[model samples]
Target: MTDTATTSSSGRRILFRVGWIVLLLLSALFAVNHIAGIWFIAASTDEQQLFEAFGVVNLLAIVLLVIPYRRREWWAWLTVWLTILPIALVVVFVPDAIGITYVVTAGVMSLGQLATLPSFRPTRTAN
Candidate 1:
């Protein structure tokens, strides 16, 4: 590759790493939010079942974040989208302070994935 192409490729790799970092941060934030939400809900309702359900969902979301971290592939994007879409929908329909927080944070997470999509292009190997 020419110098320009090499530079571009390096730049893309850097961007991809940054995107993954952002996604990781978002995952952490979501986990914290869900944990707190579960705690508050459990306290208010005395509902262990609800707590367990939300806890399981939160754990699953955090686990799924690892997929994109380990493999920058299209499916990773889909996974992240699947994780965020329900939160986004709740934000849209609920119209509460917490919902607004979800929308803003999830929106940033979505944008991070969008920015990273170009970097996920399959690298061409030499024949």
Candidate 2:
């Protein structure tokens, strides 16, 4: 590749990496919020358990993003999407039940994930 092309490609790679890192940070923050809600707030057992499950899913996303997703593994990306898409659908279908905050947050995270798609594109290999 020419110098300019190489430079642009490098810049894009860095930008995408930053995007995914932002996702990881977001997941961590949500995980903490969910787990803390279970302990610090007074909720019924069902609610507390539901929040705990949310926390666990967030933690799992963090791990997946940090490891295989960073490596641009297709399966890892798909797995993360599998987890996110369902929740996004729920937020879309039942906005009132989930609340506006989550609706907004889900939109932001989905946009962020979309922005980072180039990072997960399959690389070409020369024979």
Candidate 3:
């Protein structure tokens, strides 16, 4: 690649990494918010358990976001989908203000994941 091309490529990679990091942060924040919401709101035991379970899953997704995928970009893609699925379910089941929040956050996070796809190939060292 030409010098300018290399610089541009490097910049793109940095941007992708930053985007992924942002998604991770947002996911963590969402999970924390869900936990807090559960604590503040009065709910049946079953409902509390269900929301806590979802929060745990979100926490796991945040961890998955940081794992080294190397050549397996699909893993990263899968992580993004997994992160969105629960929120999508909540939106479907609730269809209220909280559901709207889940949908919007999931949408933004999905966009970030999609933006990173072009540069998602395996690293040279991983090959």
Residue 99, candidate 2: Cα error in Å is 1.9
TM-score of candidate 1 versus the correct structure, residues matched by position? 0.76
The residue-by-residue lDDT of candidate 1 on 33-57, one tens digit each, is: 5577665655655454544554565
Candidates' RMSD to native? 3.0, 2.7, 3.7
Off by over 4 Å in 3: 69-73, 122-127
Candidates sorted on TM-score, descending = 2, 3, 1
Candidate 2, residues 1-127, lDDT tens digits: the string is 6687677678768867776867788788889988998988637998798778878988999999889888878788778775565456656556695666666666777776776777678555445
Candidate-wise lDDT, in order: 0.70, 0.76, 0.74
What TM-score would each prediction reach against the true structure?
Answer: 0.76, 0.82, 0.79
Per-residue alpha-carbon lDDT of candidate 3 for residues 1-127, written as tens digits (9 for 90 to 100): 5687678679768768866876788888878876876787637887788768878887887767767533335866766787677876788888999888878888887787776775775544312
Reference-based lDDT, residue 22, model 2: 70
